[model samples]
Each structure stands twice: as C-alpha cells, then as structure tokens.
Target: MDMSWPHQSQPLPRRRALAAATGLAAGILLPTRTSRAAASGPTQASALNAAASYANPVIWQDFADIDVIRVGTTYYASASTMHYSPGAPVLRSYDLVNWEIAGHSVPVLDFGAKYDLNGARGYVRGIWASSLAYRPSNRTFYWLGQIDFARTYVYTATAVEGPWNRLTTISTPYYDAGLLVDSDDTLYVAYGNTTISVAQLSPDGRSQVRTQQVFTAPPSVGTLEGSRFYKINGQYYIFLTRPANGQYILKSSGGPFGPYTMRQVLLDLRGPIPGGGVPHQGGLVQTPSGAWYYMAFVDAYPGGRMPVLAPVSWSPDGWPVVQLVNGTWGSSYPSPAVPVPPRPVTPMTGVDTFDGTTLKPRWEWNHNPDNTKWSVGNGLTLRTATVTNDLYWARDTLTHRVQGPTSTATVQLDHSAMRDGDRAGLALLRDSSAWIGLERDGGVTRVVMVDGLTMDGNWNTTGTGTEVASAPVSGGRVWLRATADIRPGAARPGTFSYSTDGTTFTRLGPVFSMGNDWRFFMGYRFALFNHATQALGGAVRITRFELSVP
Candidate 1:
C-alpha cells in the first residue's frame, strides 16, 4: 500500500453530502456542547449503577489479547502491550464487568537497545500474546510473552500489582502460548499457529521437559492463534482464535497431551454485536458462585480490539457453549455474580495534572522511554531528540487509547523552551496518523497540522507527513485539541482545533482520515509528542491535559 499521506485537491466539504445521506448534519459530526463532567477530577456515579447492569464491551477501551484469571472472588486480567513501555499491563476487577489498571509486568521492555529507541525500532513487535497465570503451589503469579527475534520470557510476582521479577527465558518459540498447572502439580504449555503442540515444563517452571504435537486445525480455518489452556472438571480444554470463524475449543477427557475433539464454542459470526464482526481471542473465567463467562475482543477500528463479556456454560456431552441471545451478541447482559463494591466510577479517560510523583497508570510511552530526556514535576517536560519525521520512531511520545463513540482531548503546551525545528503537539497515532501542533522554524513558530501513513506491507515504515495547514503564532504557549467521533454510523475521521485563550477555539485542516490498518493490530491512540528535526535542545512542557467523552 502507498505509505505517503494522500494529498487532497480541495478541503473537505464543510457539510458533505454523505453526512446528509447518513441523516447526520455536518454540525452534529462534532461535539457542540462543552462537557459538564469535571475536567480536573474523575467522574462520579453509583458504582453499583454500572455493576447492576453492564454492556458487551465491559471495558470500552483497548485491552486486547486478554487472558484473565480468578483467585477467590477477585479477577485479574493481562493484555499485550506491543512496543509500549511497561509491557503486559495487569488489570484487576471484582465483577469482571468493571476493570482498573493495577500495575505492569515489565517496567520497560529493554530486551535489546532497540526497545529503548536508541538505534533500532520495536513497532508492531515488542511483546505479543502474553499468558497470565496464578500458581497455587508457590502462591505466585506468572506472566509469559513471546518477543519476535528474541525468545519468550517468564515473569513472576507474588501479587498482581507487582514488583515483577524476570524469572527466566525459554528458548522454545511457543507462539501465543498458554500455561496450565494441573492438580498433580505438573506444568504444561500449549501453543501453535497452524498445528497445536503441548509440552511439559520442569518442576521449577524454568525449562521444558518434553514436547508433543497434540492437535492441528484444518486448512479451512483462517488465522488461528492465541491459545488459552484450561482444565475444567477433569477435562482439558484449549481455546484458539480463528478470525474467519469465532473462538474454537479443543477438548480432551484424557490429559493435557491429548486425543482431543474439536468444536466451535463461539461461532456467532453475525458480528460482535448487532452489526459487527465476530468477537475473538480471550480467556474464560468462573465466578465464585460457579457461573462461567467468556471474555473476548472484537476487531473494532480507530479504538483497537475492545474486550467483550459473554455468558457461557457446558453441554451434557462436554462441549462449551458461548451464550448469545436470540441469534446475536447482546449489547447488555446480566452482571457477573460477584460482589459489586461501592467504589468511584472508573473513568476510561481523564485529566492529568502532572503533579504526582509518578506517571499515571493510564499513561504509556510509544516505545521504551529515554528516562533522562523527560521529567514530571510541575508538568511533563519532554526534551526533544534528533529523530526523523516518523512520529512512530520518536521517543517519549506519551499516549493513551482514544475513547470510542465520541471523545475529546485538549492539552496546554508551553513552547518557550522550544528551539528551531521543533514540533510539539497532540496527535492521533496508528499505523496511519495525523497531528495538530506548534512547529518552530528558525525564530518563527507556526501552528501546523500534518498527516501521514506508515506502510505496513513494507515492514511498517512511515513516510514524511503531508502538511494540510499552517499559520504563524506569536505566543510561547498554545492549547491544542482533537475531537474523535468514532461512534457507530458516524464519520471515521475526526476534527482538529486550536485555542490561544483556552476557551474559544478554531478548527484547522481537513478532516484527517483515521486508519484501520490490521497490521498495526491496534486502534488509534491520543499522543503527546515533542521532537526536534535539526538539533536536540528543544523542549515542550505540558501543564494540563483533559479528556472528556460523550
């Protein structure tokens, strides 16, 4: 595919005929009313309100490749964090419908200097398909992930919110592997892409003892990977994701290494919801009351693969049934049968004062950050680095997932420390991305907007961005904002705006198209980036960032 940003001959129509065709006016394409929710604090609602009932996308944000485990009444979830620092983000929940970030497995994925963004890059290739498990023997939690070009690593911690320790590295590939500790205290791993395999691990969980091919899917199955192993009521089960189909299960009455029978557990291909694609790849958990539920994800674009919760049960013949109402996935389901604690409603997006001693759990870096170049005190200070125009390769680009349906983010940037050839702004980042920011050239600074695409077929390399608009700025500080309207039936591209007084705002540039590239395997993220094109002393200080959603 052509990676360069496609140039448009004319600005986007102020009120496109397409909007009228869709029965939506151009004026309603973006948020017209200011959000009443507090911009500086978390939103408040009865915690039991959401817990009393919940939706399919239990977690509305991007928490993909999820593997969840239940210990007692508490549930813990782990997800893939490719190329993002603090890889293998762990989340905790009581009802499985609500979740909050607990901590991370690796503080930074520094397997090689490339992860640190020194010379090489790790885009689309850091940690993939991690398996999280709780070992009853030692009362320790384990996280395992496969790193491309590197081997698989096993991380261990006594608590889910952890000071995790890198226990060991296994030489075996184990692509999208899952771990299981049997009642006999023996450990086994299940993994494969086309042909599935099982292996016995040493008693200490450091090395493989033996291996064998257990099962293989037919060629008709498309894109089958991400195996999750489980042993329920004396039967061994393996759940594999077939994008062409839904989630399929392999069951064996005998043992881990099995003569297993294959059956489709979640084949409601009618789409994730009423008019969506099939939900794929996640783990299953049982509540304390012995109720089973499956947690999976749908390939939702511009917001990434979002998690969905579904009720489940076993058939008399020992097959797993992924429950669907009537003939489609329901938008809302009865909440999980767990204690619904009276806690503050967890906001998917929020404001960051940058006054805390540590970065918020919601914040993540594009790649492993260079700690020496950034600091957080009165605000976030990002010292510019000599990186190319490819924002994907730029260091210290702090980011969070863009909220779905509709959402808006605004940041106040102090560019007084910025030098010539420095660009500091807010961006919507994916394999394809666009930004609205301040660009300093020599002694003159300009408010600029640019958009670019990263060619996935060509090893995911980004081309120089195409400038859409620019205007000179006289001040050292400015506020930049982006409004994303990703609601179903709404336009895919979002609008960019700028403000000098922090109240009134003016729109800029054409509506930039949001990318749905599958290669990046993620949704667009709202990012804060500051990089230098010439020399390195440019710095940008962000005093405040506020995110609100409707």
Candidate 2:
C-alpha cells in the first residue's frame, strides 16, 4: 500500500475542477525539533528558529480535521477528536507560527454510550470534521459537528477558555461542516460530501431553519468533503478537500447558498516531510495589515495529520491563489505579519506533574471517562474500570499526541497498588498497537512487551496477546519509554524499553513497525493505560510524565 502520494502533477487541487493543553506542572520545553529540507529546498527551511519565517507542518502533531479562526490579533483553531474525551480542542496562537492549548468545546462525549467506549464499541467513531465559528455580535464561539454521522452536535461558549454549553443536537447531519455567522448574526452551514449544501440556522443556531443544495462536483473530483465557510467582502466561499489529494474553493457572490463558481487552490502540495502529502481543508485568515494566509493540514501519518500555513494572494479577478514556490508548496514561508504581534507562547510539549485539580488541556481521555475512577493531585491515578483483556474497552486510558518527525515519551508508574491481572504502562496506540507495561497474574508481576494486537471492523480485539518479552519485576516502581520515528518518508520503528532505577534502561521486545494507513484518521498516539483482565480495584499511579520531541 502506498501511504505517500506519488502521483501529484498539475490540475492538482481543483485546477482540473471537479470535486473534490495547558495547566499542571512547570513547563519542560522540548528540544528543537529536527528540520531537514530537500537539498534544493528554500534556504530558510533549515533556519526554523528564525523569527522571520516558519516551516511547514507548522505545529507538528495530531491536530487533524482543523478549522482556524482569528479574533482580533489572537488566532484560535479547532480540531477533530473522534473518541478522545474533551473533544473539539481549541488551540490559541499569537503569531500564527506558535500555538498553545486554550481549552475544549465538549467537556465529555455524552451523546451516547458509544462515545464512552462502552464495550469498546466507539473505536473509530464520535466527532468528525467540525465547523467552528465565532459570533462577534455576541462575543461567543460556536462549534458544530456530526457524531457517528447520525446527529450534529452544537456547542457554544462566550470564550475559547470555555465552560462550553451544549446548545442543541440537530437531527440533521452536517457531515464535515463549516459554520458561518454572517454579519447580521444569522448562521449558515455549508456541508456534505461531493455535493455541498448550505443550511440556514435559527438566529440562536440551535435549530435548522432551512437547507439547500448549492453545488455538486464533477465526476473527476472524487470524495469531496471537509467544508470551511467564510463570507469575504460580501462573497461566500466554501473551501473543501478532494482526496486522494487536493483543495478546491467554491465562491458565490449571491449569498450564503448560491450558484457558486469553483477553482482549485491546492493540489498534491508537499511539505518538508519527504513523503508527506499536501496541505488542505483549513480556512483563510487575514492579518490586520490585510495579508491573507491559508492554514491547512498535510497527511503525515502514522503521527497523524498536521497543520501548515501558506500565504494567499488574490488574483486580478478576485480569485484566491495559494502562494507556491518552485511550482509546489514549499517547506518555509514568511510568517503571517500580524500587527502588534502577541508575545510568544510556550510550546505545548513538556513534562507534566499531575499536581493540579484539572488535567492540563493537552491531556485527553481515550473516551468519556468514568470520571469517578480517576483523580489527580501529586500523581495521576487510574483505577481499573473494566475487567477486560482488551485495552480498547477500558475507560480512562489517558492519551497524548505523539510528536513528529521523531520523539520519545517516558512515564513513571507506581504499580504497588495494582491487583492481579492488571496491565498498566505506556503505549503507541492506534487500531493496531504495542505497549510495554507491568502485568500481574496470580500475585506475580512481570514487565511485558506486547505487540500485534489489532481490532476488527466491529472493534473486537485480542484481549491479552502473548507477550513478546517479559521479565519478573520485583519492585513496584517502573518506568516505560516509547520512541517513534514518524518521519513521513517511510515506515519506522516504534520501540519500547523499561527502566527500574530511572537511570539505567534496557530495550525490550522486537521493534513494533508503525502503520501508516491513512484510513485510520487519528494516527498513532502515546497512550497511558491501566485496565484489568480479572477483578477490578487494581490501579496505577503515574508519578512523572515527559514527552521529548527532540
């Protein structure tokens, strides 16, 4: 299977038409991420630290299904979280080059039992491509997305640092939608697959007023979705993604829904990551100086899709053009020139001490957790929630985005409290996963490394696969390390090791090959899991957690 897009030529992105964080302990800054550009790549690509320019995959991590909005000088972006609790992450940026966690739109995925991973049933389902909009008239932010393609969930808050409220659930499904709060305070949504449609929402945006199909793609542009709506200077534009790879724009001067005109904006665009695909789907934002920039994501799996920014230039006739160098999207560009640039933000990568009452915004539960089973003070504790051999069904498996091109994650676990048949440790999680952890059986505890556990279409998985490596561990204190090379060019290793004294470490088990199939949209992640295959009541305490991207 070819994960890297190799057939990108012209008529790329629609030129051929047709379709298409926060909180907790002191900061532990990540070492500068490695940046390697093509030999003939831009001169500044290697100077990622320069203040004047920034590299593509601007913020490298799993910030998939993105929609970015700028409020005054501050830029706020939203991304999809399928099963992770505290879904719809809100990211804040000052200079567009740097971003930090602001908050989340949904405190928990409460629409149904599936979202709670009940029975491990919600595997690859929950929130999909969401549309985020802000209503300046009310100083409120709105987020809309469909769940399981069954119903659209709407949430709203006065600020991005939110105590967001679930406004309503629409029976209407807005698949991969874009939300627009017109100047008159009226709401409009553009959504659908190859055939895009616009719908008018009640002023409160709690209910749909009406719906209309505006445009349908030609047969050539296959699989079009991901709608990002905006009303620019009285013209409405919907930016969409056309895969295997491309981004197209639909413009209408008439109204929110119109007989729209189409153009291709991005196609087969490549970034610094050698095999990474082009950037697309993100909306456009303009700086105070009237400079336009497009923020989009490139498919850099097994680490997941990442956001990239490129400049936008309006053509002589009012069409928007994606700025490119050497006939393709380059690896570096001049950063968005914002007026009164906000102060630099601390990067999201770091060490976390779970001393605070609230989990840092960056940490998300694998699903809507059984909140009663977890707590944080000096150490993060996870009580066994399910007596299942499958970690997929276990609630409260905390997850963090794995950094790219390469990064290492380490966690200290105190397993003294673990009951028999409990597994607790760090993992590189996806549909197929591998983990190094402590497993207790009949009172004997052993550090084990397991791999090749995968789920079927129904989300069933092998409960406790045979361990590849195991060692009897006497002490209750253990440290697990996971290092993954998610460099985008080809498959790489996601290796695991264990430490007893926090100083010396020994690699264990065969290296797990990271999978890069794009169909699993969430990509690979670093997960902290504790689940039971026997009786409940077993638990583990995470004393220290650090993710180093260097």
Candidate 3:
C-alpha cells in the first residue's frame, strides 16, 4: 500500500543483446534495417496509399485515453486534447491496424471559440478522457466527457463523426468516466478512483436514471481511476489499473455496474521493460470481428508512452488474461481468428525525411495549424512568423518519430541562412513539462532541456554550446540522434547526440524523459521544426533520415 514509492533504476541498453533476443518468445522486434524500405524513393507515398488499405488505426499519434468502440465494421477512438484544433483527437479505423483522422467528437468545441488565446487554454475550460459510446437501439452515438476536472457532460451525435448537439452537463465528481451499453439495451456509466462508482443510464442515452453507487474491489486486488467494463459469457468484467502491483482486472456477474470480485493482475512488471509497469488508458475492440482486444500504453520514459495491443483471452472461469509473456506482445494472435490480413513486419518506429510533396499523416499539431509556416518543397522548410512564439512553436510544431522502448533518429538540416530567434533542430517533446531539443543559435548549436515535472521555465542548457560541427550550409548534411533507455518505475532515460556524418554520433546529454504531449498535446515524441523571427531564407536540405532501436 505504499503509494508514495519512487522509481528504481536499471542498466543501460545493448544492441547486440536486443538482436540476440529478437525472435525469442518475446515476439519479433522488427529489425532496424527494415527502415531502409521506408525511405526508398516514392516508398513513403506508397506506404501512405497502402495505409489506406488498412481498416484500423492502432498506431495513432498522440491520441491518449484511448477508448475504442466498434460499430458494424468501423472502429472509433477518442482522446484528450490541448491541441490547436477545437476538440480532442478522434480517429476512425476500419481494421484496427490502420486508422485515419476521420474528424473530432466536437468539431469545434468551446475551446476553438477564442482562437487568439492559446497555451493550454483549450485544456483549461474542461474536457479529458472523453469516451465514445454507441446506442444500438437508436443507431446513434453518445459522447461523455469530464470538463476542467470540475464538470461532466454528454453530447449526442447521429454519427460517431458528428455535428453534435449542445452539451448536456451531468453533475458528477468523477474525473475519467467510462460508458457502456449492456445486452438488454441498458446503458451504464462507471466513474471514480481507488473505489469506483457506477450508475444506470436512461434509455434515451442522454440522461442518468439510476443513483450512483460506490463499488470497491475485494481487498485482494488493487484499483485506480481508469475502469473499463464489459460483459462476456454472462459475466461482467471491470478492468482497472492500480499501477501499484502492476495493472489488474476485477470481475462479477452482476449488471453493467457491479458488486464485482477483484481478480489477479493480468500483466505485472515482469518483462524486458526498463521503466515502470504497463499503466493502460482504456480498452479497444478488434474491428469487423467484434472480438475484444486491449489497447494500453506502456511507459517508454523520456520518450513518452507507446501503445501496446494484446489479445484478451477468457479463462473457463470468465476472467481476462493478457497473453503477452515475458517482454513481448506479438503483432498477430492465433485465437479468436481476427479477419484482417497481417501487415508486413516492418519497423513500426523511425524518423521521417520530408522530401515528398505532402505531409505524412503521422504528423500532428497542438491546435489548428498555421499552414503558412510550413510547406513541402526543396526539403521541409518551416518559416517562423512573428505570432509564433516558443510556447506556440512547442504546440504548433509538426514533430514525430518512431515510438519504442529504444530507438534513435538523425536528421540533417541547413540553418545557416537563419535570422534572430529562429530555431531548427531535433526535438523529443512531451508536454510543457517534459521536453528536450537541440537548437541552433547565431550559427551555434546547443542542447536544451525543459523538465515539466520541475515546471521550469526556458530550455536549460545541458552543456556548453558548440559551433555547428558540419560544413557551411552550401547543401551540407547535419544530423541529430535520440536514444532512449527505459527502465521500470524510474524516470525513462533519453539521450540526444549529433553528427556531421550520419554514421558517427556524439552524445548530447544523459538520457531524459520520453514524455508525449498527449498529457497536454505535448506527450514525449521525436519531431522536427523550423521557427524563425523572419522568413527562413535558406533551403534546408535533409539528405538523409534514419531511426533504429538498437
């Protein structure tokens, strides 16, 4: 019962050790070499087109609190947002493996009403961990959300992608609420912490009909805020994460909300993971098949959280178990026979060199993007306007790299023709709280760290600044590398280095947090940006981009 415990440290990573265990029972870790296939000419375009063939988007960018629901053949996911856009990031996937940003739950929530006021303003008025619930009887969609941690409300939509009705405020102290519709067409809502509260929803799906009741887990188990409830084989399963003794599940045969018995932990902190345990956000469904699958995030510190998909198998006794043994979750499962074909085993993690005419879908901004700041041309050159400040750049920047417990990204840039306050570099940013970047100043490059946990201001210099190590920008190549060391419970380590040649690397600093801006649209992620006081007068040539989880 020690809730105030701290994170314990671990050893550093070795590439040879990882390669030796690639095909071991831990499931296949896609080889870092496969990344070459991603960068081949026109291959990115083909990949985007091929991604169109995928029906589910299991690997979405920055979509947190990942609650998924399936209707017919379509799967929908919703998450929290402080992004520039009006509402939280919502995506639609056909197969659960491929997803597209279909639209938002509230296309233009109250957050977008005042565009001029920025910097986590969208996060302040309320709205977090919004859940998507399907009303089968009416064939409509319902969205329930916690606003500003003080209010809860529900909105009805004809389609999951909607022109939603006005919000119907539901007074409740619960912060992250999960809504489920049962077999008899009964709608239920579950909410709250160490103990949970559940209540029945009115048939109309717009109101709460039953009184809220507090449910406690049997003393044998641990429980926390995120609770996902589902019914299978005539029994109700309440999936809760304690993060104390790893995450676990509780069960009962009662109604949607239950006097459930607590079950044992499904996945404990007993794997190859370097940091804390797998603290999941919400559960997901395997599309087209209606079979259940769990989509939870594993903390890859300093870099932020990475999504892990596992098959939830049922025991004869009706308890759910995660099949990921040791330290790996396979991309495919034999049981439950999902209908989709397996995607080629490719590196799910890597860096992107923007040479193509269009921006990759994987890139996202905090709020509405100022498209004028960026354009696809002789390499990706981002012009910094007067309105875009460091805080705004932190939010508006288009950044993404592969997400794994360990990986590295190196990008070459041309920043010699830059003006004052112009910064173009490699960044691993997650929230206003956790982020680190290598920025160029007056032709000099320095490593900067913004530790969100400390709520510190300005990107602290890690080491003395160094002059640009590469040749003067007349079409020369420069590289930045990010390396992550994940250990359970302790702060995840992220170290960045740079190179004139793409091969050799010099460490920038010690390993740091891989925090994603999702916690506030700034979850830990590897991204690229160019923000200048005037037009970035020089063409930035990124001749090569590479990422490997060695």
Runs with alpha carbons beyond 4 Å of true place in candidate 2: 1-51, 340-342, 462-464
Looking at model 3, which ten-residue stretch has the lowest summed lDDT? 7-16
Write down the RMSD of candidate 3 (Cα, Å).
11.5
Model 1, residue 550: C-alpha shift (Å): 1.8
- The global C-alpha lDDT for each of the candidates, from Candidate 1 onward, is 0.76, 0.79, 0.52
lDDT for model 3, please: 0.52
Worst 10 residues of 2 by lDDT: 28-37
Tens-digit lDDT track of model 2 for 91-180: 987567677888999888887887777644676677788978888788899999998878899999998878999999999999999998
Clashing pairs in 2: 13-266, 13-267, 21-361, 21-362, 269-278
Clashes of each: 2, 5, 52
Q: What lDDT is obtained when candidate 1 is compared to the true structure? A: 0.76
Which tens-of-lDDT digit does each residue in 1-550 have in candidate 1? 4434323211123112222122211221111111111122122232223223456667667788889988755789888888888888888876686677888887788788778787787777887887998887899998887788457788899987778999988898788988887777788889988799998889998988998999989877666689999887678999999863478899998899999988877664554443245788999877655567788887777677778887776666766676665555656555554544445224556788799777877788988887888999899999986556777678899998787656899999999999888888999887778899998887889998888746566445647688899877777789999987654333577789998889998899999878655677767788999998888988999999998875
- Which structure among the candidates has the greatest lDDT? 2
* Residue-level error in angstroms, candidate 1, position 318: 2.0
Model 1 residue runs over 4 Å out of place are 1-51, 272-275, 460-462, 488-490
Greater-lDDT candidate between 1 and 2: 2
Q: What TM-score does candidate 3 reach? A: 0.63
